[model samples]
Target: MLDYSLDISAVERDLALPDLVAEGEELDALVSAEADWTQPTPAQGWTIAHQIAHLAAADANALIAIRTPEAFDTVLKQREAAGPHSADLEADAGAAKPRSVLLEQWREGRTELAAALRDIPLDRPFPWFGSDVTATLTVALRLMETWAHGQDIYDTLGVPHPPTTRLRHVASLGVAGIPLSFYAAQLPIPTVPFRVELTGPEGQTWVWGPEDAEQQVQGPALDFCLRVTQRRPLSDTALQATGADARKWLEIARVFL
Candidate 1:
């Protein structure tokens, strides 16, 4: 098995939750201001309204999970049941209603979720995706997911996504998890040490592996995260994997099932 001991403490310490909250609010505003009611997002048949509703439902579930770890499955089921509400919200997209109402719901949901996360003790364990994870790690993953899915919504809206400095959490997590996918794909392990360098949106460089290395990958962090998450194809970016093993790892990059 690949080692899961990659140090992410620095990455976690540098995360700015306030910035994530602000960006999420900005996305909510954009969703509210959208004029097209029939436009579809990349997520199957979901519209912007459905997206917002899903985010709201997810946030609510996160709040529950943060408060009572033993209730994780029940919270997930509740969130799943809210899918019909999301559909209904999307169906009313063209209705003549005050946009502020929808925005308020989104804001409230996010605020509650943030408060729950902030109140959770970092050392506390929570059930997550069939495993027990620390409260801090769970929150970090949630933030990463929110930013990535927000990007999808932004792409559908034809708006430029602002620089995602907070996305470093996702990038680091993705990079650390790449080795597992490589092993699962039955690819040969590299004989030499290698380096991986991802340049973030705000000119921040994220480097993994070794400094003096025999193999390397260097490129944009956003693109790297997208590729590793299987949200974007490797050919869509400027990322370069120099060694055979490094290239193989990229071919099967995945963070979750």
Candidate 2:
């Protein structure tokens, strides 16, 4: 059986604000330097500018959820309602603003988000979805979202994002959520015992499940992370999944709601 109670502290420890800031800055630079007539990104007809705007909006929402306590639901609803308008604005030829302005807004949103996260007590309980969650989990969720969405921007620009230890946060969370994905994929629950060996950022390996398991999956941590997050196609990765069920599970990996 998959363990839902896997340790998440590793995810917390991997949340390096400096790394995130640097990645965000690189993405901003990429967006700003791109030519106006560049091909549309995989996100429909949206251009690079729209992607940065969406990231800014997402970061802003995360900050509100972390800091306001009582207003998260309302704030999220407002953001959802504004999504269509944002898309419509991007579709209009004259509606898209300068990349510089979008970059500034993105930086501002990230700044607010970082400050909010820094201020929250790690042990404090916060509202997430319909349930209370720890501040650390909230941070992990934000990191996951940022990294995952950042992949879209990076892929659209054909840029390589060097793997960081922070990615392990998403990987750990992603792996833990695998059983959920299995169920969603309408696959049979594996009855055999297995092990997952995930290498951490610093060449440290995190072993889960029994030591003498009948099956195992192992590979470079970054590829596994990318696969689980669905940021990269599973066929494009080097992760090796032994045993029938474990391989099938990796093929349908997903993390978001």
Question: Across residues 107-145, which tens digit of lDDT does each residue of candidate 2 receive?
Answer: 888877777767787767666553566656655666776
lDDT of 1 at 25: 74
- What TM-score does candidate 1 get on C-alpha atoms? 0.78
Cα lDDT over the full model 1? 0.68
How far is 70's C-alpha from truth in model 1 (Å)?
Answer: 2.2
The residue ranges of model 1 lying beyond 4 angstroms of the native Cα positions read 1-6, 75-104, 183-194, 213-215
The parts of candidate 2 lying over 4 Å away from their true place are 1-6, 10-15, 35-38, 76-97, 186-194, 199-206
Clashing pairs in 1: none
Across 210-249, the per-residue lDDT of candidate 1 in tens digits comes to 8877678899988888887677878887889887767877
* Candidate 1 minimal-lDDT segment of 10 residues: 90-99
Pairs clashing within candidate 2: none
